[model samples]
Target: MKKGLRGLYYSRNEMDEMVAPLKFALVGKFSSGTPSIARIRARFAFWSSKDFSPSAESLVVPVWVSLLNLPVAFFHRKSIHNIACLLGSPLKIDEPTTDYTRPSFARVCVEVNHLDPLVNDIWLGDDDGDITQKVMYKNLPLYCPTCSHYGHVERNCLLKAPKNKNTPDVDSTSQEDLRIILDKKKSKLVEQPS
Candidate 1:
């Protein structure tokens, strides 16, 4: 359920600690309508024992790959081996042979990044040893089967009330004040062409 939030607080507390420094940068003063910062949190849910586990093993995950075009026996063992060596050790290959009747794609399993979770784009080489065909990779993140959302599990969904519900409301006025301040600052900015 949605509810209104408080605008201002005169008391010296956590809010003051966070917002006190930005008084001049914001507006002359913060009032009851001033908005507060907000953050979105996510949770994980487990389905079956066979599902991927974050702590069980390596960080690698399976990624579906497909050749764009200009296919010249790139799915062969030698080519696959060369491609694997260029990238890294392939956890698994979809099929030893390429299905010309289909779209010509391959599924490879690689470790998930432990530091950066984002998967970067890939460039594959053609039979002429020149980088030509761009392979596409696709992977799904861990999500709850109940709500089917990217983050958070069914047990702790926002739709259902929890044991402790104290989501603080952000003041809408502060956001407007911030926008005004930003506009003023932007107006003062002078552009210089090089």
Candidate 2:
């Protein structure tokens, strides 16, 4: 009983929101695509992801890039050289910067954005039929400091906070986000940079 692509996508998106920071898994047509060492060495960056990990526990989801598998790129040595020349240099990615200017499987870097949820969804779908109900999680909102917003936290808060940004919001409803908002675990979760 393979869950359709859309169904799988929704389910995985739900799960990823739970485990922020690490353990992002990809499930799709090429979920097991060859590891492009070149891209790995290029040092790609991942932008902010809304739901990209597992919940209540540390996760290890694969950051897989959807590839076209260009035979010419690998078969023709000249093609590789020529493309490299046009590429200019390997792109450097950061929190806000992703390797998109001229991304290459040869570059060793791939971008993981929460915006593209279908691919990860498909990948997860192929793994198991009954996985849907087991991994679903709710969307986590960012917290605000000025008006006490719901989606952003203090460190990156767009507002001014009288207290440290990491301070738990007393208003978080039933502990289901991340720690204070609505964490699925309904328990205190330790925050660490992943």
Taking all chains together, each candidate's TM-score versus the true structure is: 0.35, 0.17
Q: Candidate 1 residues 1-194, lDDT tens each?
A: 01221111122343344344444442232234533443111111212356656545433444554445524345444454445443444555554233323334544544344333333334443223334334455654554444445455557665564544333333544777767767776776755334
Off by over 4 Å in 1: 1-58, 85-88, 96-103, 114-129, 142-194
How accurate locally, in lDDT, is each candidate? 0.42, 0.33
TM-score of candidate 1 against the unseen true structure? 0.35
- CA RMSD of each candidate after superposition: 29.3, 20.5
How displaced is residue 65 in candidate 1, in Å?
2.7
Residue range 86-187, candidate 2, lDDT tens digits = 222223222111212222322212222232332332212322233322211124234344444454566766356366575556666345544534553334
- Least well predicted 10-residue stretch by lDDT in candidate 1: 1-10
Runs in model 2 deviating more than 4 A are 1-67, 84-88, 91-194
